[model samples]
Target: MHRMLSYAKGLLWLALCALFFSFSLLLPASAAVEGGYTIDLTPLLDALMPSLLGGVSLLASMVLAWLLRLLARYTGVVLDEKHRKTLHEIVVSRLQQIVTDSYEGNRSAFRISTKSEVVAELAGYAARKAPGAIRHFKLDQNGLEEFVAGRVGAKTLARLKSSPKHAPARLPPKPAR
Candidate 1:
């Protein structure tokens, strides 16, 4: 929008300059004769007007093309951002649902061996849910695994912290040798 405004200002300036130049050309010029001066510039102004208007028309067309290109690029960026945000929400929700269903009443531990299985299932689930986004965002197996593992670890830690049964135990005092 800001770019469009600047282009509009530039076009206004060009129009003003063209108007001033045409007015200046229309004013009569004085040429000295033997005993007097005569005013005449009709022929000169007639020849210049067509070429001047043509040049302005060409410049205006070029500016219009450039503005259209900028608008297309801006629209593409906004849509990509919207897709990315939607994909993130879908992945997070799916992860929570899978974790809840698989590990209910078993939050005491999230074993390292089972983490790979969970990640694999999550990748498949996401692919099924938003197939277009998976390709658009260029998500690979390694990236998906890392993302799932991180979220799972954080969730497990939060649950453990909140559970009284899993509270950290203090070590007893050591006896003097």
Candidate 2:
């Protein structure tokens, strides 16, 4: 029904435009009252025809191009930094959760995508409490490079001689209701 109404409106508008144009053609040319000046209204019609067609066509093409641009922007696939960052954070957080949860609440034997962040936090946290026993424990990962190795410092590394080799642990899955 809405589609039919739109089509009817379009046809009605076209018909009205045609009627106006035909009526415009029937009008007599203007006569000049002053010195040797002849006014021809036919030139107005001639000029209006070309200008109206050109303007309308240009406007239509521009509108179509704008709509297509909007559609492309909405539907097009654009993988950028934000997408990568989101994925990286999700994986990092999930891996960290799994690593932290796998053990019986004590420091787990292993970590995933550790790269020294959570380990440094744990080490530093333990250091404040124990100090001597929790020596230099440096977290490590192979493909995931040392993002905070320098920050861990030398003194921490001395007591923490053995950190487990970097490994990919099973990440925790999101819960199902």
Candidate 3:
């Protein structure tokens, strides 16, 4: 549906452009003279046609590209939710791996695409491992690196090291009726 809409919009724009171009070509090739100033319509049209058409095409392409980007972002969010749900343990392990690698000066393990996701996952782990300590301080990339390396503070690190690796169980299912 979205692709069809985008294609329909493009076709509409093309039709409008064609109509304008044909209309322009139908105009009489007359020169207007006012005192010492003179303007030749043919020359003006010849100079402007390519530029105008190119500008219109560029505008249409930019709009289409923007629409595609929005659609991808929406779909990506839905897929990310499903991925997280189905692979919760794997995600936790990956988050830990990234954090550990980052602490060891290999920050490239969590590049731009997954930077925010890594941060969010690591924050969850921290919150679980140290219930209240992580909330007391801001944890940006650097802070997370420090926290992962037991450099944030001894108390927090102690709690984290002693805490169980597994996430706490969510609420149990209600009794089956």
Candidate 4:
């Protein structure tokens, strides 16, 4: 439908151009020159007008096309930023739940600390800091979950269970005296 409308508009413009061409012929001719041929500058001026306007229109369309492309590109960037922020919040919340559950040994009492303002601050901090440490943290939740699960399986996690917030460092054995 749009293509048809554009074609119709082009045809109308062409008809108008033809009418203008014929109208120029009716313009009063200037006095006859030495060669006994009358030269009318009106038709020449009329002929130049369409070409000049077409050039200006072409330039205007090009500028508009560039502006439209730029708008689309920036709009996509903004939407992606918004989506990232929302996803960051979700990931932070999920991670906080998992951490709280694992630390408390069960789902019970998990919400007690999580409901606090301090938990929110901590979640926001992890969301910002952890993404840089884990390359695909923001892009994939399953990947992040697997990563956390893997870390939980490490020896440090067992030590954390016994020690809570403090894990004592293991020193190397001294050589026999």
Candidate 5:
């Protein structure tokens, strides 16, 4: 394709040059003697005019090509920036929704799932802050069951969970004999 384009450009240049040169040859020589000074200016004008016009046309085409290249570059940058910005917005909004629903859904639901390794690491951070409050800190499904049970009952334990302010500093183990 590139070779074909180059060949086409060379042909166009040759054609333009031929046209400019031939215009002089095509003109019938009309010699006028002005006070013994032979001025064959018509032939010169014919050659110069077509060449000048061709040069001007070529220069204009180059400037238009340069402007088009600049325009394409600028448009591409703007579109890519907008695409990245929109993608970031969509991801952030989805994460916000997940965080909101994780804690605000039905009361019977177990919270702060630690099944995934990443979630377990995050839970460890929270557990370290309030080690005495959290229980059944494991990756097994049974931990989710225990969390549900701890959050559902209506006894002092439930009240302690409800109003963390009145919760005891320490809680007894359920299986203690």
Candidate 6:
């Protein structure tokens, strides 16, 4: 839609320029002499055509350059978004793997490890695995730590809920009528 609007604007500008150029050609090229007026078509056509052509060419070039700039900017924004999304997915998958590995099926070990320790370990792993992504996304240490901590907290809660020890006990059967 934006591209279409740009093309439309360029066409509108060209049409306006063409209209102005044609009108300019129709204007009288006359000089006042003593008790008379002299019209010279040759000199008028020679001078006017070159300047008009130059003006139209300049306008066209400017419009083309503007359109090119817009296109480049749009492409850059699209690429940046794609890169950021890929980086996010990589980080999330790495974080999940680190959490699962640290679990090791031992509740005691999971409980003993501090949130900060887990974050540090995950951060190191992510840096090793996706250094370019971290830099491109501009993810700072604090942000990475917070993200790891949040995911870890959620995972811990989910593990606790799924564990048999935390599951609701079955109620005894109701007394016979």
TM-score of each: 0.41, 0.24, 0.27, 0.26, 0.24, 0.39
The reply for model 1, stretches above 4 Å from the true place, is 1-76, 98-118, 147-157, 160-177
Instruction: Work out how many backbone clashes candidate 6 has.
Output: 0
**How close to the true structure is residue 5 of candidate 4, measured as C-alpha lDDT?**
52
Highest-TM-score candidate: 1
Query: Who is ahead in lDDT, 5 or 6?
Result: 6
Pull out the clashing pairs in model 5. Answer: none
Candidate 1 or 4, higher lDDT?
Answer: 1
Taken over the whole model, the C-alpha lDDT of each candidate is 0.64, 0.47, 0.54, 0.53, 0.47, 0.62
What is the lDDT for 146 in model 1? Answer: 71
Q: What is the lDDT of candidate 4?
A: 0.53
- Which portions of model 5 show Cα errors greater than 4 Å? 1-8, 11-15, 26-63, 71-177
Kindly provide the TM-score of model 6 when superposed on the true structure, using C-alpha atoms: 0.39
Put down candidate 6 lDDT per residue, 1-177, tens digits, no spaces. Answer: 588567657766876886786566545433244438655557756766786687668667767877887897877876667666765566577655544544444343233245576667666666677677677767798876665566567565455335454234446899999
Superposed on all Cα atoms, the candidates' RMSDs to the truth, in angstroms, are 10.9, 15.8, 15.1, 15.0, 19.4, 10.2
Mark the regions of model 2 whose C-alpha exceeds 4 Å error after superposition. 1-19, 23-42, 77-177
Predicted candidate 5 versus true structure: per-residue lDDT over 49-117, tens digit per residue: 876677668756765776786897877765555544543344334334434444344333234323343
Angstrom error of the Cα, residue 32, model 1: value is 14
Q: Poorest 10 consecutive residues of model 2 by lDDT?
A: 131-140
Residue 49 displacement (Å), model 2: 3.4
Candidate 3, lDDT over the whole model:
0.54
**Which scores higher on TM-score, 2 or 3?**
3
Q: Report residue 77 deviation for candidate 6 (angstroms).
A: 6.1
- Model 5: residue 31 alpha-carbon error in angstroms: 5.5
Full candidate order by lDDT, most accurate first = 1, 6, 3, 4, 2, 5
- Tens-digit lDDT track of model 1 for 1-177: 587668667777877887788676544332244438665666866887786677688667878887887897877876677767776777678766654533343445433235566667666677788778777778787876675566566565455335444335445799989
